[model samples]
Target: MSAEFERDGTAWISASTGTRWVPVIGLEVHAQLATQSKLFCACEVRFGAPPNTLTCPICTGQPGTLPVLNATAVELAVRVALAVGAEVAAESKFDRKNYFYCDIPKNFQISQFDRPYCTGGGIQLPSGRFVRLTRIHIEEDAGKAIHDRGDETLVDLNRAGVALIESVSEADMESPEEAVEYLEALKEIIRYVGAGEADMEKGQLRCDVNVSVRPQGEPWRTKVEIKNLNSFRNAREALEYEIPRQIEAYESGDETRFPRQETRLFDVRAGVTRTMRSKEGASDYRYFAEPDLPPLALSESFVERQRGLLCELPEARRRRYREELGLSEYDARVLTAVREVADWFEAAARLSGRPKETANWIANDVLGGLADPKIEATSIDELPLKPFDLAELIALVAEGTLHSTGAREVMGEMLRTGAAPRALVAERGLEQVEDEGRLEVWCREALEGREQVVADVRAGRIKALGAAVGPVMKASAGKANPRRVREILLRIIGEDE
Candidate 1:
C-alpha cells in the first residue's frame, strides 16, 4: 500500500494486517448501459415500472422467442473500451453462461467469453500505481427478487435483459484505498463517454471484489470474492474488516482450518463479509455461443468513428490541468472529476486567461455550493451560472474591484439568479473600497479600537497586522480592500518612517 493517503476529508482508517501481511484486491464492475431497451428485447427499459410489467416473450425466454442484439448497447460498450485505451476486438460474439437461478429466467446469461469485446488496458490510480485490466465484456442483466416481505418473494423483471458492460481488473491493488480509486476512475471513464451513469447506490453500477491476504513478497493465498457490493463505502469497510479477520484466522488456526477461496456477501449492517457459497471455476458454468445471436463484426471506418467519439478523459484532463495550467495536483483532480465542471472550468480559464486563479475560484467557490460533487447535470448550460459568468467574477476579483470574500457572496447570488457578477456586486454594494480616502477612515477607526494591537505592531510584533486588518474590514462592512487596508495601517503605525 502506498503511504500517501487521500481521504478527501473523510476519516478513512487504513486496513492494517499488523504490517506483515498484504491484501491483493481485484474488482469486477458491471455498469448498466444507458439505453432505452433491453440487450436482447425491445421492451422499454424503464426503472420503477410495475414488476413483471416490462417482460416480453423475448426477454422471458419463451421457447420459440429468439434473442437479437441491441445495436446501441454494443456501440456504448465499444465507447467504454476505447475510453480506457483498450483494444476493441473487430469480432465478438455472445455466449450462453449457464446458471440456474430465479433471476435468470432463461437459465443462462448471454455473455462474452473466451473472446470479449475488449481486453488488456489499465487505470492508473491516484497513488501512482497502475491497476491493470483483464477484459471488458458485454452481457445482459438478470432480474431481481424482492425477498424483504414477510412471506412471498416477488420478482421484478424490469431490469432483466438490460445491457451491461463488465470490466475486470487484475489483482494489482494492494489496499482498500487503491481499490476505491480504481473503481472511481473506471466509473469516471464510463460516464465521460456517455456510456453509463455508474451510480452504485441506484444499482446502476455493481461490483464484485476479489480479496486475498498473503505474507509480504510471497505466493498467493486463498482469494475470497466479495460479491455484489452496492456502494464503495461498504466495499471499503468490508475489506477493512475482512483483511484483518483473515490474518487473525491464519495465525490462530492450523493449515487445514484456514479459510479458503469462496464467495461471500458484504453485510452492510454487520460490516463484514459472510460466506454465501463456494467459489466456482470457469468450468462450473457451461459456456457456449448463443445460437440465436450471430457474430458481431464492425468495419474499420465504424471503429474509427467510435474512436473519434473520444473526448479528453479525466486522467488526461487532470494531467493537463497540472502540467499545462500550473494547477496543483489536488486542484486538477477536483476540477476534472466531472466532465461538465471541467468543460466549464476550461471555458472560464480561457475567457479569464488565468488558469491558476480560475481553478482556485472554481474549486473553492463553484463546487463548494454543489449538493453533490459528482453532480448528475449533463452540461454546464444546466448549471445555475454560466462559464462566462464565472470568468467575469474572477476578473472582478483580480482587478481589485471585489474582495475575495465579496466575490464569494456574489457567487452565492449568482447560483440563484444566474446574474452577472458585476451586476450582483452593484446591487449588493459588495464592490471593494479601493478609494484611499475612504480606506484611511476605516484604518484610523481600526487603530483606535485596537490600540494595544497597534502598540504591539509598533513594538515590532508584525503578526498583529492581522488584528488591525480584521477591525478595518469590520468597520468597512467588509467592503474594504485588504491590500489598501494594510497600507493605511502601516502609515498610521509610523512604520512608514
Candidate 2:
C-alpha cells in the first residue's frame, strides 16, 4: 500500500516501493454548444434527427466543400470565457487535428491547437479553492459509432459537425470531491450563460480525467488518462479506483517498469479501468493550421459588448444571498442550488416582508417536499401556488396567525385548491388557538384526564411537561400554539400544587 500525505489540500498517494509522492489530475470537459447550426455547416444541430437525415455535403466532409466558421459560436465562447474570468485572445486560430476513425468521415478534426480562443480562467470552489483553467477552445464533434450485438458497426452522422467547446483545466484538482466540484461549477456557468444545455445524462457534457499517484515531497509521476466519463460520480469513482491501483504498482517495486502514459476506459458496472490504448503526444496528431477558415479576430468593443450582457454568476449570487439577504450559509446554498429555485425565493421574499422566513420555507419545506421523484418530474411552474402565494403563507406564519402545523396544512390546501393563504386559513379554521383563557381551560381538563402524568409533574418530573403539551395540541386539533400550550401547562401544574 502507498503512504498518503497531504499537499495543496489534497491527499497524495506514494508510488509503490518508493518515497516519491504522486498528485496527478487534469480534466478535459466537452460542452456541446446550444447553437442552432453546426460549427462549419448550416445543418440544424438537432439531437434526435433520423440517421444521416440532417447531413449535408459540408458536414459530411465532401471534397471541395470548404468549411466556414460560425460567428455566433464565437460570441457564445466569449460569453462563457467572461463568465469564468478568462482572458480572451484578440486573434485565435483553428487547426486540423488529423486522426482516422470510422465515425469521422473527414479523417481530420478542425480544432484549436496552442492559440485557443480563451485561456487562463479559474473557477473558485465552494471551499475557496481555485481550479485553474488551461483553455477553452471550440471544435466540431464527430459522428458516433454504434455496434450491434451480432454483426456490424453502424455510424450515425446526425451528430456530425455539431459545435463543441472543449474546456481544459490544469492538473490542479487534488481529490475526487474537488473534481466533481469543478465540473459542477463549470456546468453551472455554462448553463447560466446559455452556452450549453450541460445535461450529463444526455451526453451534452463529458469529461476526461487524468490521474497520477506520487509520494509526499516528490514530483508527479507519469499520469494515466481516463476518458469518456459520462457522469460526475463516474469521474470521481474512476479516480478513486485508479489512485490505489497505481499506488500498488509502484509499491510492488514496479515503478521503473510501469507504463507512464496510457489511455484507460472506465466500466461503470464493473467499476474498473481497462487499458484502451497507448496515449499519444501532441506530435502524433500532426496538428496544422486550417487553410479554409481564416483566423478569428475580435474587436475590443465586441468583447466588451458580450461582457456587458453577462449576469451575476452562481458564486456571486451565492455571496450576495449570504451578505445582502442575511441568510446562513446552508440556507443560501439551498436557495441558490438551482437558478429557478433562487428566482422563486427572491420573488417571494420581495412580497412576503419576511425574507429570512420566506427563504427557510422555500429552501427547507417547499424544496424538501418537491424532492420526491414523482414531484421532481413535474415542473414547478405547473404547480397551483405562485410565488406570491408562498409569500402570503410565510406572512401568515410570521404574524402568528398559523401554528407551524397549521401552516403546513394551509400550504397543502394552497397546492390542492390554489386558494389564497389567508382565505384558506379562515375557511378551514386553521389559525392557531392563542386565547390564553381558553387554552388554560383545555390544559386543566387535560391535566385532570392524565392524572398520572400530572402527579409526576407535581413530583418534580419536569420532562412530563411534553405529555401535557401533546394532549393540549391534540385537544385543539393541532391548532393550538405550542408555546401557549406550554405556558398553560406550567400554570395548571403550579396552581394544582
Candidate 3:
C-alpha cells in the first residue's frame, strides 16, 4: 500500500506503507442475442456475409429511416434477467448513446440508459463466490471494422444493428481466478438460458474488464477499463497483467502516471495495456430517449411466460447432479456446464438405471471422445454417440458384461457408427469372460507363468495380486471379468500353498 497523492475525482492510493494490494474487477459483457434478425432492422444477423449486404436503410442510418424494436430481442433480454434472478421492469426505454466510430454509421448507439429492462442479479462461480450484477439491457450492435486489407479501415455492416444484451456486474471479484470464474459462469448462464451462443471468438460474446487494485479492506476507485477482451483466457490474462501494473505504478510514487481512471486497449499480441482514451462519464454519452422507438412495455403475462421459458439453469443442474445423483462437485460442474451435456447425462442416467456410474462413464469415457481427441464430449451432438447408447454402455459395464477396457472399445465403436452398445459388444466379442472354467484355465495358466507373484501373494503379500490379474486379463484379451479373474486367481494361489 502507498500513500495517496493529494486528490483527484476518482483516484485512490493505499494508506499504509507496504500492505499487500488486491485486485477488484467488474465486467461489462456484451452478448449477442440469440436471434436471426437485427435489433431495429430485419437484416439477418448472419456472420461472414458480404460487406454492407445485410444492411438496410434503417441499420445503415440512412435519412428518413426509422427504427423498430425487435420484440424477440426484448424477450431474450428478459429471459436472461429472469434466469439470473434479476427484477424485470415492466417498462423500459431505449436511448441514443452518442458516440463516433467508423463502424457506427449513426454516430450513436440505441441503448438503455437509466431504465434498463432488468436490474439486480448475480451469478455464483464454481468457487461459490457470487458476483453481483447491476443490470441487463438490450442494445444494438455496431458494424465490424476490417483493418486487414490495407491502411484504410473498411466497415462491414453485416453485424450492424444486431441484437445484444449488455450485462454489467458489480466490482465484487477480487482476483484473476475469480474474474475468470465470473466470466465462465456468465457464459454458462447465457448458454443455459438459450439466450446466445456466447462464443468469444465469433464475436457472439465480448467483455470489457474494469481492473483496479486497492489496499485490503479499502473501497474501490481509479479503475482502468480494458476493452474488447475476446476470450476468458485473455480476460484472465489482462487482469493478471494489469493488476500488477497498477500496483507497481502506485508503488513508484508517480502521481501523474498511475491512478488515472481511463480506458485502455488490451494488446492481445504484445500482452500489454496501452492508453486508448480517457474514460467517459455518463454525461459524456448524452443519453436521451430514442425518438424513433417507443418505450418498451411488457405485459405481466409476457414476463411470466419468459420466466416459464427459463429451463433448469446450470447451477441448479449442478446442485441436482451432486445432491441427488451422487456425483462429485467437479464432475457435476463439468457435466452441467453445458446444457446439452446435462440433458444427455440425465436422460442416460435414467435409461441406464444408474446415476453415478452413468456420470462417470460420461465424464470419463463418452465425453473424452466428443470433438477433440484430447478433450471429452461436452455436447450430445458433438458425435454420433446417443444418450440411449451411452446408458446401455454404462449398464454393460455395471452388469459386468463388458470389462472396463472392452467397454472403452465398445464406446469408441458406438461413437463411430451410432451402433448399439450391446450390438458393438457382441460384434467385437467384447462380452466379459464369465465362464468359471474358462477363467480358471486362464488363471491357472497365469499362475504357471508367474509363480514368483503367486508365491508372493500366497505368503500374504496381497499387493502382488495386481501383478497376476494382468496376465489373466491379457490371456482373455481384456474381455475377462476382472472380479471373476481375481476370485479364480486367489483360488489358484490358495491351492499353491
lDDT of 3 by residue, 1-497 (tens): 22333222223334445455777889999999899899998989887787788989999899999998888888888889998889988899889999889999899999999989989989988787888999999999999998888989998888889999999999888877888888888888888889899988899999999989877677876999999999988898887678767877877778886769899999889888889999999999899999998898888999999888989888888888788888898989878878888888888888988888888877886777776564344566667787888888887887788888998888777777778888888888989878888889888887776878977887889889888888889998888888888888888778768
| Model 3 Cα RMSD, 1 decimal | 4.2
Show how many residue pairs clash in every candidate, following the order shown. Answer: 0, 9, 3
Better of 1 and 3 by TM-score: 3
Pairs of colliding residues, candidate 2: 16-250, 16-251, 17-251, 20-215, 21-214, 21-215, 22-213, 22-214, 22-215
- Tell me model 2's lDDT, rounded to 2 decimals: 0.84
TM-score, model 1 to reference: 0.91
Which pairs clash in the backbone of model 1?
A: none
TM match of model 2 to true structure: 0.92
State the TM-score for model 3: 0.92
What are the models' TM-scores?
0.91, 0.92, 0.92
Ranking 2 against 3 by TM-score, winner: 3
Cα RMSD for candidates in order: 4.3, 2.8, 4.2
Candidate 2, residue 371: how far the Cα is off, in Å: 4.5
- In model 3, the number of clashes is 3
Judge candidate 2 at residue 478 and give its lDDT.
91
Q: List runs of model 1 lying over 4 Å from the truth.
A: 1-19, 372-380, 495-497
